[model samples]
Target: MSGDNPVDRPNGDDDNERPEQSKGGDENNPFAAMFGGASTEQFAQMLQGFAQAMSSPSSGPVNWDLAKQTARQTVSAAGDSSVLDRDKRELADAIRLADHWLDDVSSLPAGCSKVEAWSKAEWVEATLPTWSRLCDPVVARMAEGMAAAIPEEMRQSAGPLLGMVRQMGGVMFGSQVGQAVGGLAGEVLGASDIGLPLASPGTAALLPANVRAFGGGLGLSEDDVRLYLALREAAHQRLFVHAPWLPARLLGAVEEYAKGIDVDTSRLESLVGQLDLTNPEALQNALSEGLFDGDEIANTPAQQAALRRLETLLALVEGWVDTVVTAATDGRMPSALSLAEAVRRRRATGGPAERTLATLVGLELRPRRMREAADLWKRLTDARGVEGRDALWAHPDLLPDADDLENPEPFITGASELAEFSDLSQLGWDTSDPPVEGTPDDNAPEANGPDSPGNDDAGPADGESPDGPDGPDGGEPGTDRP
Candidate 1:
């Protein structure tokens, strides 16, 4: 009976056919070419590796560990050297001196509690937390869109595989973000170089290597360049520290923009429909090229408003820093003007990393109105003096608005009035109250009457009051009376 039953016959012909069946399975696999004809065992191992990566606790909308690893690799690939001890000491000394110089020029107190030199990799690591804050909103939105785009029936059928797709998306986003940050690491001269407080508060860090590269072609001495850069960094720190509301406002604007981000579902659907899950590399390449970015999706009204607010705020901040640095270095550093121009050019024509970031985030960090903002600040300083100018930063509402950037004279002229009004309000003046009957109003015309000092009818003469001096024509004192 055992010989007759194929299921029970382990030593029968069926046992001899198992190897052929395994070979057939490998040959029929859709992923064979992607794996370069890997054997079944190798394929299984590959899947296991992918599963491990996907299941990694660090995996979310981004794999921060992988991002850091990629950034370090990028820094190495770019041949960025370590920060030497000499460079560190020199930078620290420059920054300390720069802070002292800033004290005489700015009303704000010293903002940097520590000054240090950093290697490119260090910059990436130090600034990545900020990068996460900036990037997560955009990534999360995309991930949510992707998950929602899947047909309900398909998602229900896919079950756990859908979760795997999200994991893959995280890996892809991390790779792209790492590349962007790595590129930035090589270019940024300091933690605050991008007009953002990307580093810890009161910590001013300079990348000596980038600073040296920045001065290489400027025909200026290294010391002067370092000092000038240090002044700018210190000035930025002062503003950030003094204006406590700034960091949150800037980051909040970015987050707000990202929250309003709406994907072009049609375009996203097309891209997703074309994705080949077996070849994850293609998805990465597409993301690197900005598959998520399209004019249709980028031009939403809400995004435009957010971008405008963010850009305006950035421009104002940069402009204020520029004005302060210029004032600080003006007669002290002979290379001040040259360095200022160089910075303007550098910002106007951003580096590769900036463009990459723009592509990744759909927000251009460059301050388009920086020059205007600088001019506004300079004029404000001239009109209002240092104390009044610095007072504008006491509150966000007190700061100049976007409209003020277009023609700053109004804001500058009105600053005193605004300040006075603010002071009055602070002093318990009720602005909403009607004017008292007995109080003299400068805006009101003088009433003409016999008792009024300037009344012609009460004067001793047509052109003179009783107490007036002789007329220009030297008429007798009372003869001019009409």
Candidate 2:
């Protein structure tokens, strides 16, 4: 038998057997021979052994590679294959035409007018940064809370194990967000479709095939539909690029709300104790329901307020987008309203997207106030010229509150007075109730209550609580608990 054939010899045969000089190699390691028969598996085992000896834990941080790969798989599952060359060219041409038309209507600078086509997967790659910025705060909180929940005794004793577990948590969250973002990519036709500047600034993007598919059942000519969508995309980029601070302000609101996510260590423990993490769907369900159960930990008023802010901000952004897109469309497509309604329904009834994001970090990345917001913006734009309307974005104080949407005209046109749309800062409400002398920072953990995790790092105060206070967080509960 050839020497390579290890099984040829009898079990006890020692003749012709040679002891490897390399003392520390796992015998079965595939890479043992590359380093003078040192098995990589053996090296890992030895390192693990050393860690065990030292009682040190290792490994944490997300596996971005795996997350991105899984996101691609999610996109594939969505099956958006409609972007052909002709469709892309037609979409680009339409964006150019729409930009020309919008120039006559408003003074917003033309943002990268070269329209690009993005496949659903491409969309994910492009927009994942925005998702990451919005998601990382909460995910970090969740992961750290998980890390902290381990008793100090166990953390010190099982350092390596703890580290490994934390790394696994990061990887797990990354996968979760990727899947959710991928699913969202299928639904969105452009950078700002969800009103969060999901893609890079200045680059107007569209999913031609998806747009065509979205408009297909409406029975609109593909050309007209493409043109209409292009206008929407152009309009979004114009507002986003021109109003430089708006994106950060809006994104900050989301981050602020997420900062309030107090990891219910109790719920997390229960989930970690039972769920099969290898099965991502099961893991997803556990993550979504865990942190989002705001009622369980509705311990603080700050959380409630943060939730409200996020909802209101979401409403304003979505409302503005809807108003502008509608104006740009000029009811150009016979099916414009139909398509809008379909989009609204799709957003209202989130499919896998809800599960995907919820699992990642317990944020339900949806605009619950889209319809109300849309109606408010439509009325406002009708009353105020687009420039007059866009002036609202000049400062967050000018945006409508959740209450304002209920009776928009008063806020929309009747009150040019800054007092109505303005906040405690500009409305002089700040002086009405200064923090009592010796009052601790409200951003600080309470003096007597259960501590708010990392309350110190709560993002900018001008957070977007969105319009509806009702979130997976208690009503108006922000995905806000960073």
**C-alpha lDDT of candidate 1 relative to the true structure:** 0.63
Model 2 lDDT, residue 127, Cα: 69
Tens-digit lDDT track of model 1 for 322-361: 9989998878999999998888666545443234334433
Model 2 stretches with alpha carbons more than 4 Å out: 1-61, 77-83, 269-294, 297-299, 351-368, 413-482
TM-score, every prediction: 0.74, 0.66
Model 2 residue 63 lDDT score = 43
- What lDDT score goes with residue 6 in model 2? 13
Candidate 2: worst-modelled 10 consecutive residues by lDDT: 1-10
**Where's the lowest-lDDT run of ten residues in candidate 1?**
1-10
Per-residue lDDT over 1-482 for candidate 2, one digit per residue giving the tens place of the 0 to 100 score: 01111111133222213222221232322212211232233223323333222332222233445446657876786585746898677777888888887776654557653467988888877766566566666566667767656666766887777656665555554454454556566666677666667755567888876777677787668777777777777777766665555565556555555556666777656765666635545544454444434443323444445545554665666666677666666645466676667666555444333323323323343443456677876776677655556656554555676566556666666756433443323432211221233443232212111111322344433443533222334333112222
lDDT of 2: 0.54
lDDT value, residue 406 of candidate 2: 52
